[model samples]
Target: MTAGSNSISPIPVAPVGLSSRAQRFVEVDGIRVPRQDFRRHRDGWIERGIPVAEIDRAADFQDRWGGLALPPAPFYEGGPRILNAGCPKGSGAEGWSFPAGAGRVSMPYGFMIGPDGAFGIDAHRWTPLHAGTDGWVESLALAAHATRWARTVTRIRGRAVTSLDLGGYEPVPEVQGVTDTWWRGEDSLIALYRGEAVGLDAPQCLEAHVYEGLDEWGLHGG
Candidate 1:
C-alpha cells in the first residue's frame, strides 16, 4: 500500500504479543503462536528456523488479524514492519497511510509510523556508545538508514524536515539539500527532515508547530 492508502488490514481481534527478542506473535482463543527465530543480517534481521507448527500458527494468526498474512520472506531491515494495521490516524483517506493499529512489530530501536504519516523512531533509549561518538553523527546515520529502508518496504517516501519549531535542532551542513530537525528528549532525540513532523507526544518533541501534512519524496538512496 502507498503512504496514505487504507489498504491496511484492520486491527486484529486476537491477542498480540511481542517476545523478549522482539518477535511478534499471536494468541487467539486460547492458543499461543510464536514467531520464527530471527538471525542478524547486514544491519538487519531475517527470519530463520521456522517450524511447521509456526507456519500453521502464522496462518491462523492471519485468519484472525484481517486476511493480511506475513510476507513470504519476513525480513526487517529497519522501521516499523506493516503487517496488519490501518492507516495512521488524521491522514486523509486518499493515498497510502501508515495507520497505527495492531500487528505492527517495531524494531528494538523503536521505529514507528506516527499518526501523521511521518516515519519516526524512539531513540530515547540509545546511548552515545551505540555509534561510538557523541551521538549527533550516529543519529543522522540512523535516520538516513531508517528512511531508506522504510521507503524500500512501504513504498512510502518520508517527508523531509527542513526546520524545527523548537530548540535542540542542529543542521547537518555536510549533507546538502536536506535540513534535519531533532527534538531533544530526556536522554535522546527524535529527528526528522524537511516536510516531516512527529505525531504523538508533540510536547515531548515540540510545544508549538504547524502540521503541513505528509509529503512524498523521491526514491531514497536513489
Candidate 2:
C-alpha cells in the first residue's frame, strides 16, 4: 500500500465511511506500509475508563507510523492521551472519545478518534472531520501524493473561500465529512477545512487548499 504500489487500485469514488477500511496501508518510500500498531500501548490505559470498543478503534490507527515521515501538515504531533479520563462523572463525553493525537501546534484542543468510528477535533465538544480515521489517513496520503505531482498549489483563506466554483468536481468519499472535505475534478483536487473554525468557533479560520495541474495518475491512478 505504499506510494506507486500496484497492489490496491486507486479508489474510484469516496466511500461512505472508513472504519472498516482502517486496515488499509499508506505509501512510504514507494512501498505500502501499515500504520503503526498500538496494541502494546493499550495495556497501560485499560483502567482509564476508555471503552473496549473505543480503545480498539483508536488502537487500530496507532498514532504515528514507525519511521514513516509525513509532510508538515496540521496533524497529530506526539501520541494519544485519554482526554476524558478526568471528566467529573456526567459531564464527560456522552459516548466515548479516545485520544488520536495532539496537534503539532498549541491549540485549545486535540484530535479525537472515537465515540463511534469518527475522526475529529475535541474542543470540549467533538467536531467530526471525517467519518473514520482511515479518511484522515487517506487525506494525508492524498496531500503527499498530490503535492509531488501538482504544478501549482494554492491556498485560500477567510471569506475569499466562499467564491470558488466547484462545478465539475466530485466529493472524495474516502476523505468526506461535514467539517472537512476533499473534492476531485478533471485535473485537480480541493481540500476544505472547517474543523478548526467549527471546533474553535472561529469563523475566520475557514480555508481551502487547492492542488492543481495533476494528471490522470495523480488524480486517480493507473
Candidate 3:
C-alpha cells in the first residue's frame, strides 16, 4: 500500500488474503464532502474487501470505500457514546452499545456499531421538523452542548441529556441551543434525544429528561 498525498491513500490488497480485522474495515474520505457526493470520487479503496459488519461501524458507505487513516477520535465527557438503549450485555467499547434508559438522546452517527437503530443527528441535512409544515415556530430555539471522549450527560432546562463521541467532527444542533430541539414538530428531523422537551417548562423539562424518558429517532442498523 502507498500513501498518496495528504488525505489521499492507495491502500493495496493482497493477491489473495487479508487479516481478519483488516478484512472487515474499509475507508472513505473525511467529512469535507457531503456524504451523498463522496461516491462521486473515483479510484478509492472499496476494492480492499472490508467486512459488512465493520463497514456498518462507519458513518456511510463512502467511508468504507477509502482506506484513509485517521487518529483515534478525541473524547470528551458527555459526547455521545455509551447509553441505555437495551444494548446486549457487554457490548461495545465500555458497554457503549446503547443508552441506559431515561430518555432518547441524539447521538452523532456511528457512535456505536452499525446503523442498527441509533439515532442519527447530522446537521448537514436540512431538517423539516424545525423549519415548518406551514407555520414555523417563529420564536423557538434549541440549547445543548457536549464534550468529546468521555461519558457525560448534560441537562437542558433540567432535562438530563446525553452526548456521544463525534469523532472530531463539529457539534450537531450546529447552532447550539437555538435549534437543538427546536425543529421536531414542523416536519422536522429529530436527531438524538433522551427525553421529551416538548410541552414542558424548562424546570419541568428536566423532571422528564432521562435516557429512557425520551424517545424520538433511533439508530438504524442494530
TM-score against truth, every candidate: 0.19, 0.68, 0.21
- Which candidate would rank higher by lDDT, 1 or 2? 2
Best by TM-score: 2
Q: Per-residue lDDT for 49-142 in model 2, tens only?
A: 5556555555444433222333345333322222111111112548766555445567777767656667787885678988876577667667
Q: Candidate 3 — which residues are off by over 4 angstroms?
A: 1-5, 8-53, 56-110, 113-156, 159-222
Tens-place lDDT digits, model 3, residues 1-222: 221223423332311232222222222211121112322222232343333333333323223222322222211113232121222222244322222222123433222221233332222221222221001111111111112111333333343333332233332232222223322221112333322233122223322111212223210100
Give the Å error, residue 157, model 1.
29
Q: What TM-score does model 3 achieve against the real structure?
A: 0.21
Q: By summed lDDT, which 10 consecutive residues of candidate 2 come out lowest?
A: 82-91
Off by over 4 Å in 2: 1-51, 59-69, 74-93
Check candidate 2 and list the clashing pairs: 1-32, 2-27, 2-31, 2-32, 3-27, 14-173, 14-174, 15-173
lDDT of each: 0.28, 0.60, 0.25
Q: Once model 1 is optimally superposed onto the true structure by TM-score, how far is the C-alpha of residue 133 displaced, in angstroms?
A: 22
